[model samples]
Target: MAMVFADPEMLDRLAKSLDSKAGAIPQLKSRASALDAGDHVSGLPAIASWLGDTAKDLRRRANILRSPSESPFDSLAAFGLPPGVAGDPDAGKKFQTELKAILEAQKNGTPQQRAQAVKDYFATLSPAQQAALAATDPLLVGNLDGVPVNVRYAANRITIQTEYTKEAAYLATLKPTDGAYKRTQERVDTLRSFLNPRIKSYEDPKTGQDMKIEVSRQFLVFDPHFGSTADAKSSPFPDGRIAEVVGDLENADNVAFRVPGITNRLDNFNGFTNGGYQLAADPNGNERPDSAVVSWLGYDTPELGDSVDPAKAFAGGAALNAFRQGISVNLKPNAGLDIFAHSYGTLVTSKALQAGLTNVDNVTFMGSPGLGPNINSVADFKMPNTKFFAMRAPGDWVSYTQGHGKDPADFKDITRLGTDGASGHSQYYDPSTGSLANMRRIFYGGDAKPLTFTHTSLDDEQIGAAEAREMVGFLHSKVPPEIVVKMGGDLDAAVQAHFAGRTGVKDLLLEVHSVLGKYNMLDRVPPDEMFGKINDLAGNVAYKQTYKAVKDKGAPDFVAAAAGKAAELASEKLLGAVTWPVVKLLEVDRIANDAKQFGEIIDRGTAEIGGHVRELGTELGREGAQIYNDTKELSEGLFKDGGKVVLELGDTVIRPWNAGQNAADIWKIGDDAKDKIFAKVPDIAGGLNDVKNTVVDKGGDIARSAAETGGKALDKGIDIGKGVVKFFGG
Candidate 1:
């Protein structure tokens, strides 16, 4: 037994390494960006192209060892329960007669029908007998795919809970230093995941606003995923928690199953689920989208350094078994199904399809490393009627990680769709991109228009000014499915009226004050209105503060400090020139994007606002970041109290926040790298993130087309096969 835990520090390091690698890949041999030259793609000579490819390959090879995943199983004890454990020792003996009878009856039907017949057989058993089996032999009933959802949920609860109880009791008898403690802790961790799955909150990549969704731990595969072997200690990590679902799998007419890449865990499943929720959500107008999604982190995921290992995919067959079973049991006859994957996940997905993932209509890959070694093209997937689709963001670096196999985008056998959000390898699901829309159209019938340019021009190649606007708009839309879906409507009139006053006697606030005004939005609104607005915004933020003193203060000192400063910026002579246009530009935006721009314009178009403009910009960027952190701590906790459904504009609390904030800071610094090392990081790092409308993300713009028709639960494996995982929604 082992106490398996993902070291947060190690994970953070891995993300940083990959992020650096992502930056280096696009920057290979040149200080200028790839899109800087209009002739880089189509105008290039054949030799130059080959050199570029060769150079990229060399770069990937050099960095290939950058992040190999560490599997705890390698250092832990061998598989199988410890001595004297009773894991239904009588399971086989007791099931022999019933199994034989059921098989005899199941012999005549098609695989699908035979599976259903087994469900029928279980249904025929008296409730008491079924309960007895669930109590003593749940592995048999709970694991079989063809079993009814109700039966599976019931049996799994018993099997999982009973195993947990037994393990817990045993754990109590052992010392903390016991050899069994670690493994038991690992076991208990897996079991507890099933019992108390996590909630993932993220800023929607497409919209750039915070969203929340719960990752439901549906199935619990507690045994060894690699099966019996002489090198048992080196076997793949046993599949553990958890998996999340979106949509109604048992009742939905269409479903999709998603296999994840690196850094996936039961704890982080919500990030993907959030993408699915957005993907399946009803478009702004008349259509009601009906679909389901399942995000599966069902296997021991390969992390940083070991991400390219074949075992990860080779062992994916068991994860496939779970998905196949999910499809087998809950699927309505003739309903549609699709399989989706990304990066290393493509290996798992392809291997599963090649092995025998029947009835899946399409197998798709986004930012794929490649298909596994044996599989070469769409032709390699043997499932009848299965079409293959591929999408790749223009700058994504995963195309270089070929140890897993060849870039699927190069295969002529498959249909290719251009990516909207593929600014980075993992950004395919961003709502700002067309990638998610493309995939949704591919998986669900829809009309989507993905960007088809092949690097000839860099207009939409990376997240740019337009992308930022869309992201901001996505956040502030304040409408259904845009970041935080709220038809919550306008702020209360009474509340609005109460805080409607302007400040005239404000003091002289300088550099940092000017910057903080924009962060707290002091510079955006009317100079006279800055104080009242800041105080009101602070009051709203204060509502969520957990500390009684801060709560009593209404808006911590930060609010008053921010407000007081903004009031002073109104009359400050140095900034007086550009203040109006800056306010106008920012009034419509949430994030403080134009602080630096206005500062430059102030110098160029008006007076010398002095060298401190950059200083003020950096301070704005830094304060913006801190304000985000402070409020997120409050906003995230406020959900339980029903105070605020989601925080307002300029909230950068997601993983990508650092990148966003850094980008802002970089914009301010403009080339002033001598000042602070932290402020210079984004200029050195890669794109914001590998964030896609990930899981069933909305990136392809795939989801946008085809007249777009329609649109969770731990209860029934939480809609596992729907391929819809959660994103925040009411």
Candidate 2:
């Protein structure tokens, strides 16, 4: 049967004509009443009464034409179809015809208009009617934006099952050698995978235990075509666009759309969906089980070469914006919406934002090359209340390319998070990483303090210090408590005095070099060898000055005096071989050897620390210079404030250094590096304990300070440009 719709414009015109005719009835009735009074005609009164009744009927008919029935069935009732038409055999066909007509009328309308039309049309259908329509024309209702999500889920499931059966049957009829058989089989398998719920396993970050989560699969947009010529050749993908939700989107408190980038296809849908599962998982650390994640492969992602083009991103952005609109309307009240975009997907998201995508609470870009060439600032995006966040893990060189625009990490409006446990471009969603943890915090609407990028030097210094402490603790375990009590006291004091003397030597040498450099006395030094030469000259000067100072104060060298005492003891033992001096001489020799080994260990540890510090300084210096060059016109104050933060955090290194030293001091009594007694030394342990407490307290202070400083800078509207002053420590 052909579909037909009543022309709303024609009805409107007819209503107006009837209303105009009805308006002249009152004048006609008045003229008739006057004529009856003058002529004394009894029948004129009846005529006037008849004219008035006719006018009321005309007005009633016009009202009906002006306001059509909200329900399609009601509209059909005026055409002689009863409300009980559901019992009639032809009613389903009639209803479908009318619904199709309504849909056709809205075909040329805007997306929102069409959506509203679909929403209103569905509101008139009974549950049984809806189910029947979904069963008969699954494709029509499945991809419609304004259809209820639950209904769409049902319709899409039927579509999936139908496509799977068709492909599977077609494949079985073809021989293995047939060119189409493999692709058909692959499609069948892909469709079949979505038929059942999937169980995913992830590690709970807080408890460090493996946990399992099961998620229902709902395909909002599923196209089984693999872009074979037999299918639609004009389709963008070799495999069709897909969007799979990992949980109940309608009921979820939080919904995150995961947009992937580059080389994504139906073949990788399951892998992409795994990221959705990770987002949906609610570990005990931050329990938010009422969450859903959508793996939205709604566009043909570009391959590596095609990634440089913005055409795909722009097109994908339009589709994503429409899809998000559908989601926004169907979502439960007060449910938060967020976008987790990666790589080129960040570009896609930026385009969507430019296209007026709204209602997003947060947007996170991980390892993004750029937003786009056109996106110069956060103001370019239409989202007003949305919080923007970005992260680039160490060695994620893709983000540094800045191929699209400014790196998001360098965008002042974007809050940069740490990626400490993640690496490269793909590990942002890894459960063990701080990147994922911060993502969860944002998704769950928790308090997420921005984590600073870990400076390489600080990380290296901590690692070295930890290793040194562990070695010291092991040496302490090998030492006999009795031996340490008998001879360790004097050795400990000598070691402390030696460390104190060496501490000022390095500082004094550095000070002398700085003075020379300031006065241009080192101008003739070759740039390549300047540092080595300066260290040599400065060290010699420092040594002479220190010798003079020591002589003036008559200070004794504790380590040398200890060695001299040992020699005297050995000489006395040689004269009294049968006496206690023999045993004493052995103890003295052993103590000297242990002390020498301790000094060597400290030297190696400090040297490693110094190397790391130098590397860190060089890297930071380059970064600071780059920042200065980038933001010289924006704000010098930002660069200065950032430098202050770095210097303040640099003070944290002393805590670990002190811990290492205390561990060494009490553990220096072993006869050899390996053979030693395990005993707890209270004084050294107490000192180490103090350092540990201080480190924790200082770390908290740094976090608070960074947060405060960052907040203040943002509040002051600092135009950071490409020079981002990241808050470090937390």
Candidate 1 per-residue lDDT over residues 1-730, each given as its tens digit: 0111233344445555545555454344353444475345432344455555555554553342222221211101111112122234453345436855776776765555656667676677654444444445556655555665544544555455565566666667867655445545655555544444334444466785656554333442323232222111221133344444555567776777777786554334445545565455433311123566666566666644355456767687556754575446567777688878877788888777666666688778887877865677777776558877777776665653344566787686777777744577777766645677666776676555442423322223432322333333333332223211111111122221222221122322232244334343322233334433333434433332223344356867777566655544543533434454454443433223343444443344223222234444554566556555544544444443332212211243454556566556544443333333344334323211222112123222233221121110121122221112211101
lDDT values for all models: 0.49, 0.59
Give the number of the best model, judged by lDDT: 2
What TM value does model 2 have?
Answer: 0.46
Off by over 4 Å in 2: 1-95, 169-187, 200-216, 226-237, 284-287, 447-730
Query: RMSD to native for every prediction?
Result: 39.2, 38.6
Model 2 Cα lDDT, one tens digit per residue, 246-344: 666778998999999876777556766666766666543332457888889988776543466677799999988888876566778799999999999
